[model samples]
Every structure is written in structure tokens, then in C-alpha cells.
Target: MLRFDDLQLFVRTAETGSLSAAARLLEISPAVASAALKRLEVQLDVRLFARSTRSLRLTAQGELFLEYARLALQNLEDGRQLLAGSKAGISGLLQLSAPSDFGRNTLLPWLDEFQQAHPQLHLRLLLGDRVSDLFREPVDIALRYGAPEDSSLVALPVAASNRRVLCAAPEYLARHGQPQSLSDLARHNCLLYMLGGRVHERWRFFDGKRELSQSVSGDRLSDDADVVRRWAVAGVGLVYKSWLDVAGDVRAGRLKVLLPEWRGEPTPLNLICAHRAQLSTPVNLLREFVQARCAELLAHAPWNA
Candidate 1:
């Protein structure tokens, strides 16, 4: 007889690629995870994993067994969903990942309201600028900006933000006169945000029928968007920032939008989740709530107007 607990541990370990990672996802010790796998292998009378100092690999038998284990776990989840649907109450820990600035300024407040509405649900929110691997991480859902390239996850569009504004403070603009054309940007100091091992210094602008790219240079760069925004507000240099982050400052006349008419492409925000055959009641409820909240907040935003 195979224990479901052992089966779940096996599936998680295979999905995450390490016993320690699986244990972290399951909120257990690595030793316990190793013991569970050992017991599972003993029950089946076959070695499941070929382990080394740096990596773990599945044996031929382990690969075949994993398929059946995934099916069994998914079936159990489907059964739980059916039972929960009849009761109409969502109860479980919902793990979420989102960017630091958006999570703090936008998503967290909405989550507070959601928690108040669903008192029984437990929510864990992880905030970071770097993208987390959903398959490896323990996150149940992620709020992602820009289009994700991973086809394994199910991405549902929740909201979208317009082209980011390239702006600086009035003081900075006074010192380094407004750029007359895209080529003129090379002369001015620009604050860049680094991502994917490159600093995004090229600003794209549109002039009705034609598009142009401006190559700008900056001595200061940071991965954190909030720090970049603060530097721009302090009159250090020009920055291309999202409206969601600088809308308040722009409205208050602290930060000014440069080349407002020549904006770049818009970015869509998505709620990405693992492509499981069945979703638990808690996951389904939180997904719906987040979708609604995102739509509401983006609709009434005053910056674009």
C-alpha cells in the first residue's frame, strides 16, 4: 500500500528538483523529506533517485512512478475541490509572489481587504523584483508584469498599465534643458534600471507615424525601482518609470513627465499559476478576488487622465 503523504513528497521533490527545496515548500525539514523518500522507495523496492553532491537525477523506474504519483495527487485534489464546492467555504494557505514596489503600494492594500472578506483563508505574500520560478518556488500564484515566456504556467490577464513615462524633476530639467529630439538625450544624464544583465538605457519614443530610439547614458543604476524613483525625485537625473509608481509624485508636481506624447508600449499584468488539472477552492476564490481588485484599481487611476 502506498501512503498519499509519501506520494505527495515524491511528487514535490521531483517537481522542485531537490529534497531540501521540496521540504521548504512543504514546510518540513530536509531530513524528514529524505526519510519520506526512503520509505517510499522501500515500499516499492526500487531506487527512485540517483543523487550526487551537486544535483539529483531520477532513475528510469522513478520517472515511470512519478507519472502515476502526479495523477493520483491531482485526482485527490479534484476530489477535495468537489467536496469544497458543496460546502462553499475557502480555507487554505495561499502563497503569492509579486514585484516589491507594486506589491507594497498596490497589491498589499487589496490583499488586506481580501483577508478581511475571507477570514478563514491564510495568505503569504512574497515580494521581490526578480522573477521566481513557479515550479521550483512554493508560491501558489504570482502577479507578473510584462508578458511571461514560460508556457508551462497558466497566465490570466488581470490588468494592464500604459506606456511608462520618462521623466525627471523640474530642477534637473532646468540644469539640462529639455531634449529637442531623441538624439539630444545622449547629452543628458539618465537613471537606468538594470534587468536581465543589461541596463535599459535606450528610450523608445513615437512621433505619430514614426518611432525612434534614444541611446542615453547613466552613471547610476539600480535593480530596485523605488530607489530609481527617489533618485529621479531628488533631481538627480531622468528616469523612465511606470505610472503606478510615480503617478502620485507627478500629480503633486514633484516629478514631471518628459516627452509625454511619445510614450512606449504598454505592459500587461497577469496572474500566473501552475497548470494543475484542478484548482483548490482557496486558489479559485483568491484568483477571482484579485482579478476584480486589479480591474477596479486600474480603471479609476487618475495619472493617465
Candidate 2:
């Protein structure tokens, strides 16, 4: 394989038009530079220089190879600069995965602000409810609800106190009457969402003393959580989702919190990744940005108020 140092020396020699001057510029002996040039010529089986005592000049073959050698050196320099910038936390592209509803309704805005703040940074977002395989997928990180079910992955808490809320539109409540208790949910049409190919018909809540899990059914089900939220807004049925996902609707009175006394079990938001090494500068910055924004948003949520 051709060495980069050889390419650098060849380009420098061509620019200086003197083997001794190029060697001096590169902080090497003239003899070493001469030997290196000879090795390069022998490797390619071509005479690179028409030598004279006055000064060296590039031969026909040398001129052709000089351009290619300069290009190779320039590309290597560019790569080195990129690595240097990365070390200083300057620029990078972060590939991320997030749940569909939260990714769209919550994270999309946050991402916009984060991107605007760092113009050199780029982002690739995979929005869906399906659990992404961090090891297999090209994603560098993921925004997930609850603790990671995969014990091997590292989960960093982004929102330590985020919780789901069960809500319904005022129009739907007026038609079917409000559900006063967990048992009352059975009589109501509960909208279901899909996550990782399974219907999320089972709802879990905390009643101050213990955890409660209830199985619910509805006339409609959707793989997209945002669709389920929209159905609730349209007064099709009840929706249980992250308070962050429907905070705007609740504040707008498009949906009302059901059973305010009982809160759903806290499903802490986490930044998930296959390994700790994946938490590079851009990924870590994004994690901190999202965490701070989530805290601010949840604090001002209508349900929290």
C-alpha cells in the first residue's frame, strides 16, 4: 500500500521545485527526501523528476502524477480537520429514533430549535412506535418511554417524572358520561395504540397505594399513537398517552383529563443506546436539550396545573 507520508512529500517537492527545500520544509534530511522520492518512483515504475544541479523539474510522467498526489494529500488533510473538529465538539450528524406521537408532537419542535442553535449539526430522525434495534439499526440514539426492556442497552433518564394521562374530549364525555373509576373504563370506548406490533390495550395506573393494570378495547385501533390521540380529539373514544403528547389539547379544552385523582404509573423518558460509547458530543447535547425542554413543558402542562 502507498503511504500518506510519501504522497505528502511528493506534493511538497513538486510545489517547492527543490528536493532539499521540500525536505527542509518537512523537517527531514535532504538524503531522506531523495530516498523517499526514489522509492515512490520505483513503486510506480515511473521517473518523477528530470534532475539538474541548478534545480529539479517535473518530467512528463511526474507532472501527471503530481496532480493526483496533491489531490490525495488534500483529501487526507480534510479528513484530519474533520476529526479535529469532532474532538472539539464542533460538528456531526446524529441519527435518532423516537416514538411517533412524541417525536412528532413533542420532539420535532425541540429538534428544530436544537438544530437552529447549532448550524453545523445535522439530524436523522426515525419516528415510529416500534422499538428500534440500536445494534442493528444505524441510529446512534433513541428516545424511549419507560425503562428499556432490553437489559443490555444503556438507558439514560431524560425525563425522570414524565407520566401518561388518560383523557377524553368533552363532547365524548357528554354523550357517554364521565368515567369516575377504573371500572368505569370498561363501559367507555377506549382507543388503543400499537407499539412494536402489539396492541396497547392494557393500561396501567397508580392509585396512591399500588399499581393497577386494566385491559381495554375500542371500536378502532391504530399503529400510530398520534392517530390515536387525534381520534380522542375528534371525540371518537378515550386516549391514554404521555401528558407531554396531549398537553396542548388539554390546555385548549379539546380534551379533559379523566380520573384526575389517579395518575398513570410514571413512564420516565429515557435516551437509549446500545453502548455508552455512542453518547458522543452531538448525542449528549441533544439529550440535555430534550431533557431541559421536557422539564419546562411538563411543569407548565395543563394536567400538572
Candidate 3:
């Protein structure tokens, strides 16, 4: 039943030793101050002040209440300050999900560097090909390829220009002749990967005029994209994968681009969250950090050369 304004007025009046003086300090009129003091006293059922026309003073009861009232206001202010500082500081658990190949091959070290830059930040990474449901899971952010199908989720571009590349190891190429044309892919062993319970055997490429579709098959196939990349790197078969995923291999001479004249499928990367509100300071920083790293790596892509 006690109001906060009345309590504040009581404390301010006790500090100033005059109701009218406290009213002026609080920018309130004399009548309102008197009413607030009366309300406080009535709620507490005790006389808070002994007033003379010339002066005002707190009763013993009022003196006791003043200490608790001051503590309450101070505690409220401290809570507000703590909340503001927490929002400004990037120091919390950031749970993220990303593709298997990119996570193992690239994101691990990038995140390590990112965490080093923010020593207070904690990370929980869930790396796999399976998509994390942001709305229903503990994940705070998800790194995904292609534009988001859900309009409700917020997607921030990390590598919008990134795309898949057809590549094979030199050892594999030495045994299986390199495909000279898109049509020749049928004759070569193309490492296949499964996504969403289906094999991604159909490879699409674009020349200047039209798209070239080729149905590829190989002796190897796996649901994990990282395995498919590894298969290509081990001279098992040719693999069509993201340029970012194969960039390091190409640079190390472990893999070589098969067809330079054709453009592979687009695999733009983005950071997705359930909603715009989830884009906190750490999430935004992660997005920017990954974006910069991807740009730095993609800059060295063999085809880019």
C-alpha cells in the first residue's frame, strides 16, 4: 500500500529537516509534499514527522525508516548500473552452430583468435551439417549457407560472394584424367555428400550463357561434408565444395581446381538468429570476425588467382 514517491519524499524531507525545503529541492509544491508525508505516515500507521509552523523534524520512527528507505534507493540505482554495464560488456556464453567442414577446417582457429581478443567471452560451439533450430534450441547464433528460408529469422551476411568449387587432388588427377568439359564429369569419380537425408549428386555450373547440370557419382559418399572434402584431399575423388573450404588445400597443393571456365553453385554464408533482438554485442562481433576471416581466406582462393 506504500508508494515509492511518498517514501522518497519522506527521506528527502528527513534529510533537509523542512517539508517545504525538501519540496523545493524535489521540484514539487508544498501541498503535494504535505500530502505525500501524510500518506506515508498513514500507510506505516506511525507519525513520521513532528511539525511546527516554523520548522519540521522527523520522529524516532521516521529516523528508523529513513535508513531502510535510503538503502532501497541505493540498491535500485546499483541494479540499474549493473544492468547497463552488462549490456555494454561482451562477457557471456555465446553458443554457435556452423557447418561441419567449415567448422573443423576453418572456424576453429578463427574463433580461438576471436576468444583471445575477448578474454571474458565464453564459447559453446556445435558444429555439424544438421541445422540448429534457433527458436527451439539453446543456440544463440547459427552460421548457415544460402539465404534463410524463414523470413522471421535475422540473417547477417558473412560471405555473400562465396560459392562452391570443383576440385580434386593431384594424386587423384594423375590417375583419373581431369574433366575437360562439364559433360566429362560423368566419366570421373566425383565424391558425393548427403544433405537433408538426400545425396547432392547433381552439380550445377554456369558459363557465360547457361547453366551446366551434371549428375555425378563416385565410389565414396558421406553425410558429413568434411568427410567429402577429406576424400578429395586424399586422392579418392573430385569434390565440389565451398571455395572457402578448399582454399587452404588448394594453396597447400593438396587440391586443384578442376574446371576454371565454369562457376560453381552459390553458397553464401550468413549468421542467423531467431530474431533481431538476439543480435547482441558478442553475436555482432562474432559475425564481423567471421566475415573478415572469410574475406581474408577467400582472397587467396585458387580461382580468384
Candidate topping TM-score: 1
Instruction: TM-score each candidate.
Output: 0.80, 0.70, 0.71
* TM-score comparison, 1 vs 3, better candidate: 1
Pairs with backbone N, CA or C atoms under 3 Å apart (clashes), candidate 2: none
Looking at model 2, which ten-residue stretch has the lowest summed lDDT? 84-93
Model 2 misplaced regions, further than 4 Å: 1-89, 301-305
Q: Which ten residues in a row have the lowest lDDT in candidate 3?
A: 73-82
**Worst 10 contiguous positions by lDDT, candidate 1:** 296-305
Instruction: Give the Cα error of residue 243 in candidate 1, in Å.
Output: 2.7
Displacement of the residue 228 alpha carbon in candidate 2, Å = 0.6
The pairs that clash in candidate 1 are none
lDDT per residue (tens digit) for residues 152-271 in model 1: 778877666645677889999888888766677788889988655578877777756888888888878998777788889999998887666666677688888776667664656777
Clashes of 1: 0
Query: All candidates' lDDT scores?
Result: 0.76, 0.83, 0.82
Q: What does candidate 2 score in Cα RMSD to the true structure?
A: 15.1
Report the error of model 1 at residue 127, Å.
2.6
TM-score for candidate 1, please give it.
0.80
Model 3: residue 101 alpha-carbon error in angstroms: 0.5
Q: Which residues of candidate 3, in runs, are more than 4 Å off?
A: 1-89
